[model samples]
Target: MALELIKGNTAVAEAAMRAGLVSYFGYPITPQTELLEHLSARMPELGRAFVQAESELGAINMVYGAACTGLRTMTSSSSPGVSLMQEGISYISGTELPAVIVDVVRGGPGLGNIAPSQADYTQIVHGGGHGEYHLIVLAPASVQEAVDLTGMAFDLAEKYRMVVCLLLDGFLGQMMEPVVMPDFQPVRTTPPEWAVGSPDSKERVVLTSINIDPPNQEQFNVKMMTRWEEVEKNEVRYKGYYLDDAEYVVIGYGTAGRIALTAVRAAREQGHKIGLLRPISLSPFPTRAVDELADRVKGFLVVEMSNGQMLDDVVSIAARRVPVDFYGRMGGMVPYPDEIANAIIEMIQGEHDVNADGRAKWLAKMRELVGTGE
Candidate 1:
């Protein structure tokens, strides 16, 4: 291919299909509904399994059963819908099955509007489901990036035998961008040896999360911890801009990071030694990379569409080695580049230390600009 203009949701769906997605089960929800709608028609057209389950709860279980066969399986939904699927997500994790979950986040604590939000940061990145489990979370800022990540998600899920979430907000899901689609991959129809059915195996294979004895459960948990160490070592990902000689750094992810880039560029033209670090993987968060910046930069500015979710992560990583300021918008609000640029400038001019009240400062700014957003 040639590059084609497409919406983010549709691009991800098509890319997953190309990546040999054999089964999809989901309930429609705003922002992400387009993804389900696209797959509903296409999956069956290709002789793959596609089901519009009765509810989000039902949809996730369908994905779980399909995944037991060790084929490429997935489901997508927005914030509220994802909340409904939490138990199923935990079950898939407990069973150590591979599944890709696309979470196009929307505003919410409960039934919030269909507007874009990053509020689900702690929810998804920190494991919204019950019990001890690790999820590889990938956040993409553009339609092209979302498409690229979609294929990668399936591969990673199987590689780790765990759930992988492709997380982005409504803005990215509904926005249009040009993308170079990936090539179609060979779909696997037969079950893996560890899965429910495998004729070659002499003994019957059983798959379940249940470990009745306490010592047995502890042993299983220890194995998961060892696997997570491998994931942390190999999967940390991030992107940097103008960092070589920069003195001040900004940290963010997904759409927030993309917007921060525009602000950083503007600051560059103004002779400010500022840069941006956008984390592509939220879980195994670029911890060491950020720690290095804490030593290298004069300060760090944390930005987000949520009220300081990722900011807390940066703050903990930086550990007051450098003063960290924050800027954010909540309830589906998105901060403008100029607002972030202004934050960068304030960060440079002020004598604030690591103990500075970032929320208070951000609230002050918000108070002054309440009626000014365009």
Candidate 2:
């Protein structure tokens, strides 16, 4: 395995091309434009179709059309641009299309900035697009993880007959790091019988979410829930470091997870029993794994680039089982490991400020600042 220094965004594009993706439809957006640019320039040599769509919506619709043909396809954009594609994403999810969407998240709510942010946690992980559906969301912390997981996204999307998204942020996408490319192997995709261009196709297939009849819509929703349950069971991925004899666990994902790992190492040197729990899969959110950790650890500390969106998942899993502390930086601010280490030390020494209501009052103050009212 030869390693080369590459930015995370470029790695994703390279992986897609190497993995036999012949169709690329995307619109230019900050932090992720390099990916589209990379594919646009390189894909033509492979005789692949690369289009710079007029808008995010147009780009996703192109993906929809190509995916309906049962060929490997992909699209990418940042948070705001991804928001534009949600309606199309929901339709794609409803029809069980096999496609990959890369979301290099920036600060949000509206054209926030061109900085790294984990603010899309609630949107991507909680089914951002309106519908009774979920997209398999993978969060990668490094350039290597970004490339490797983008390849996995395509595989999982084909296997599940659904959409899969690689969720990273500007930091991971823009920062250069050493990445080893996987061996070039052909992508093997077995399209379902219901797919439009399948061999046995004898009639046109309609892919839409519009089931106007109430009872039929209810039935479809139930079926979707069943699939989600299976996803929860089999698809959760996380990495546990230094957890063997730890008293506190630090939970994070994407770039924040890497920071948390550094903090864990620092705490170990200081003789603090802190470990790191890094979620690789964000949607099928490794909740049960987190709950299991509660049995051993005294508490869980949730850290993120946003104001505790992922922390909510941690709190849900840790409820009544163990104490969960939350720390976050908002508006696209990134935190250093020293800050995380300090927070862990404070928690270990029982130095966190708890309100009279026994709630972490800082959480309430943070929500107030973010105006989330949580």
lDDT string, candidate 1, 290-372, tens digits: 99999978999999998788888888988988888999988888878998999999999988587876767777877786744
Tally clashes: model 2. 0
Reference-based lDDT, each prediction: 0.92, 0.85
Task: Rate residue 358 of model 2 by lDDT.
Answer: 19
- Top lDDT hit: 1
> Candidate 1 at 273: error in angstroms?
0.6
Q: What TM-score should be assigned to candidate 1?
A: 0.97
Best by TM-score: 1
Put down candidate 2 lDDT per residue, 267-308, tens digits, no spaces.
999888888889999989888879889777777788899868
Pairs in clash, predicted candidate 2: none
- Give the range where candidate 1 is weakest over 10 consecutive residues by summed lDDT: 365-374
lDDT of 2: 0.85
Off by over 4 Å in 1: 367-374
